[model samples]
Target chain A: MARRPLQEINAGSMADIAFLLLIFFLVTTTMDQDIGILRQLPPPVPEDLETPPVKKRNVYEVLVNSRNQLLVEGERMDIADLKEGAKMFYTNPNKDPDLPILTRQTRGAVEENITLLQQALVKDPKNKQLETDLKKWKGKLSAIELIGEYDELPTSALISLQNDRGTKYAMYISVQNELSAAINELRNELAQDKFGVAYSELNPSVAEDKPKIKAIRAVYPQRISEAEPKDISGN
Target chain B: MSKFTRKGKKGTPAVSTASLPDIIFMLLFFFMVVTVMRQDDPKVSISKPNATETEKLEKKSLVDYINVGTPIDTRFGTEPKIQLDDAFAEVVDIQFWIKENRDRRDEAEKPLITTSLKVDSDVKMGVVTDIKQELREAQALKINYSVNKGSALDNN
Candidate 1:
């Protein structure tokens, strides 16, 4: 027996329902953002505050050549080291949340260090003498080294620059300048955070520490080639 | 014709709206579970760039992050890996985290509607763009790469 024509179901309410549902989802569904760790950089107070060490503190020497063989400190560090340092940086330790001013002050010093490093490296034609000096310390050619002695090193942030074969000395400066600018800006922004503590006395102010800020350099590979140890002597 | 019997479709069942109410109810339920039930992953707070115009948002432990900072040279120089906090993450690591977190939320039927990226203030524009490019490709393009808006003292 043929089934009676399925009653032509009229579900006009589907439209109202759909529209209502759309509005409901659109309205009630909170598409709010998940904020990351960010706090304001408060103004500096006079007293030396008890500060927490930077939570993400790992110093890495990032050396980039024309060939893009990256280096850490004096040694040729592969990509793996980069990850470790970055992660270690994150794990260094969270600053005590109270000392916002301290965070700002220290960050300023790092900013200067980064800025100076950028300036030194990005200069056109590059200062050959300085690159040479930096390299002499690196170890003369024949050594694909990865590190330098860590005893009592300068506290400044350093970014050494060297170029690959056939690269213009100008390229060395260009890279240095670009990298420096980026890093300094970041430093400044970060320093303004609310989480840091000053472990030391506020004897030296950020303003006073300007010229004494950390140092950054642009070392040419040809120059660094000299610093490369005699593979046998160093290894 | 028999008096044109009513075709207004059962007077809309007085249920107001269907389908969507069910869908929204389901979604609301899903998020409520996420915000309350799911084991919140450990969160590492980067020194986020503060913004004066910014509002206090509900902090999410499940943030999709792109670490735009100096990657560590773990073995000094032998192996360079990008660490998402202490986790030795690769570019693929970022990709995996992005995908994994998003997927985890998605599986629970709560697709991540947004993301946060921590780029060091000194990070380059190109680097930020590169990360953004990756996020876009991953379809987690809706993101908030934190930046220092202005000193809080700016207004005062």
Candidate 2:
């Protein structure tokens, strides 16, 4: 019996199969680009823990009620202006000398202290006191520089975000985002002014420029303190 | 000049069908890599609020989603509720879920895990705050408040 040669499989249908699969995926697939505001929740406090008293001047209080109305530092404000308001509060550029000065001294004193520490360190390389003092002075110098540019030192400014229990989630998130944007804007401005680079371009993965970014972050750390949700009806 | 005239005479020679499959296959692979299947079908309708200062959640694997919105089905009632995974859950369930998710991850990766709260704009802050408190107790501090992109001026 003569064996019939195997028939050649049709290659023409391969393209059709590929097209079918492609279309199936195209119909079912959804690209996930998850974008949102990243935040770090404060660690839970003990019920017995007493709330520390914050100076009225230092605390930049932002309140959102059930109606999504904003009460910023006791005055009504629009959400559109929250960023600028937050920036102004954080930088406190026109810092009244009459206001109780926190530990921060004049910018000249910080700079002079830093220079003296550097000279002392050079004279006594093994002096741990000199090393620590130099570090402290350097930190103050950055804070001073940040204050000089933004008006208020970032470290000294505390943002307290409070919302009513009945406040819409949308309003709460909007306020939080605005506060973050203010801090980010300040950082970006500092990065641009000092390093001549955009804040988005400052990658921690890059070794050489990491310190510059770290210094900026140290100066304008995100200091949002979320207060417990209050009952609007009760108050 | 003579070679060019001869090539033009063929009039685009049936535009080779040989690479058709390869082209289609390339697209298929591209979609396969980029496509992320919806992990949980939301039981409640969620219309997220918009914000200008949004950051993209970088690692998908390290993120867990907590959805909060009013139930779409009438049987569940008109009031808003929290949906953990596939089922309706209370605020207290957040700690349990966080622990379960944390346990599933490798010890080294546990710290990087973030809980993305996809809360509906219409939901009240009371529920969200409760959820946040539970998360804090569970030591899942990192959170991403999921929102759509919108201009700051739109708040008005």
Candidate 3:
């Protein structure tokens, strides 16, 4: 407001200020991450398989009370050999390899898994929840029973087990993470083969332990089930 | 008009930024303290598994919550009647919720449904899975599991 000649604002100073602001923002900006499943969003669900997507109808309810009593198919699973039986749920002798992975575990693997579980319970007897956890783990094991050849099987069959809401979330989440891992494994293994089920991959230390190829994906109700060719094509 | 001052050369534009770090730090601290963290706490206990891929998110739209009280009115009634957070309920309810959410969005926008499952840390696996299965069955556009800071603070 001074009654004197005004000096023009230098354009050079403005350019310098702009560059500084640009650098500041560039240095501090965070990357855009995918917090949850980031899909194209109109919908991510693909069409259901020509074969009806396995519904929740086949879920076998396994209940474990706070006391750790295991129930499978509505009967008490012998705590001593529950794993052995679960393995048998997945593996049937000399039938079509065309069978589902949800029903193809071996009697021996089931036994070994049960023994390991029993050992865990025996080692950690103070915690009553361990036994309950061991019971639910069986279904996950059945779905992800990895074979000697590192081949994997289809575990698309949804298995629902019920535990008390009062139970620790850790126990449930671990079981779920295990199931997701198994399902992920099953999908990766089958992605390469035809007719789906393949041997479970064993660890590279032993070729039998290497991960098998997986090929199955999950489908739930409520979402439109249009066949997205990609889901069916890659396999 | 001809007065000379020793500080005449101090009028550099860069001088303004001398205190920029402190000013910015103070403002950031002010917001950090004054602004209540818009956290999505179900006020229920939730146990989240450790995953390297997990990330913290800012405001997410109406994600579902589960507060595990004594399970009552649950499908697993024979086990015991303890109040359950929505996590242990049937798949159908979750599907219904998702469809409702999807339908409520703006017509021109791509229906982006972000179904979040926040179960108490001690909730049952069967219950959690059932909820997830329901969301999946509902054909959720995208689903994410939320972890509580209290649980996450443990390892650190």
Candidate 4:
């Protein structure tokens, strides 16, 4: 005898269940991706070490008062002009006497220094300082290899960012953003000029782009020194 | 005699919804994949300042957020308060929070964790400076200042 036709299971409730779940997720979960300005804080300073004096020309001073006014390089300026001023200070294109000095380093000079450091390391064998110096010179040699033989490096330029205690967080971030933008713009231009690619396009995580990114970063290192906030507001 | 006769009493056929469950399931899966679960309900209401040079924070799991702003409850007063996880905290609590969070992570992932500071725009820098000092003391140096993506001019 033939069996009776089997009945189909109802799936009408399945859609309702899925809709409920979807609504729950939509309400509970945040869709906005977290984006931000990345920064690395300097380690706490030791009491014994004295602060090194930076040359006046090498320091690009950016002061933000509590009143949200910007004092850039001893000149009162608007927020919009800060990026250009920073770029000018960083590049020092005209070899201005007031701007940061750009020292040219030849490949031969870097290699010679590396060899000397290596010889010194061999003799001491346990000198951590010599080892670190050797590693640094080797890094410089590789960076020089990537970009041409001789390059003018901003060896001592540092952007000093000082803010008042009463300074608004918004103004502080805006200043920081401009400083980062200045560095990024310089890197972007250099990357485009050297590798025919934007700096943002080269990811350090990728093997091939690692050296390119390194070379770019080595040429234009981010050297923003944030001073401890004081009552710079002059209240 | 006709081999087949036409049926005349039939009404218009109802639309088939056999694939409705499948469509809803697809949407449900999409939401599930993209959804980032809310980890902490911020006690301090933060309206992040705007910045031009913003970057996407990769690996959300590796980021611990520290919210700073005016406390939502007026009973705490108007001063900007720091929020560590779900509850309001002081500047001094950052070190302990960092240690606790770092200890929870795997050994290899400890150094890779980032601290994202979600500070309000109207807040003063004094509180932020205190937090930074606290972070530096704790040796949690890698930080990201959470900001809205906008042009620098917009900030002015």
lDDT of 2 by residue, B2-62 (tens): 7656443445457778888898899999987777766788899998898888888988989
What residue runs in model 1 are displaced by over 4 Å at the alpha carbon?
A: A1-235, B1-48, B71-81, B106-109, B147-149, B152-156
Candidate 2 residue-wise lDDT at A228: 66
Q: Which stretch of 10 consecutive residues in model 3 chain A shows the poorest summed lDDT?
A: A218-227
Candidate 2: where are CA atoms >4 Å away? A1-8, A97-156, A232-235, B1-17
Clashing residue pairs, backbone N/CA/C < 3 A, model 2: A91-A152, A93-A151
State the iRMSD of every prediction, in order shown.
16.0, 1.6, 9.9, 1.0
Whole-model lDDT per candidate: 0.39, 0.82, 0.43, 0.88
- How would you order the candidates by TM-score, starting with the best? 4, 2, 3, 1
Candidate 2, A1-235: lDDT as tens digits:
9999999986788999989988888877878588899999988888899976666777788888878899988899989898998887766666654232334456787778888888888888999998988886676566555434323353445888988888888888888888988989988998898788877688888986777776776667788998765675554
Please identify model 4 stretches exceeding 4 Å from their true place. A150-154, B1-6
Candidate 2: RMSD over Cα atoms?
A: 5.9
Query: In terms of TM-score, which candidate is strongest?
Result: 4
True C-alpha contacts between chains kept, each model in order: 0.03, 0.82, 0.23, 0.88
| TM-scores of the models, in the order given | 0.26, 0.82, 0.37, 0.95
Q: lDDT by residue for model 3 over A108-142, one digit each (tens)? A: 66567778888988989877787876764454354
Better of 2 and 4 by lDDT: 4
lDDT of the structure predicted as candidate 2: 0.82
Better of 1 and 2 by DockQ: 2
Query: Clash totals for all models, in order?
Result: 50, 2, 60, 0
What DockQ does predicted model 4 obtain?
Answer: 0.82
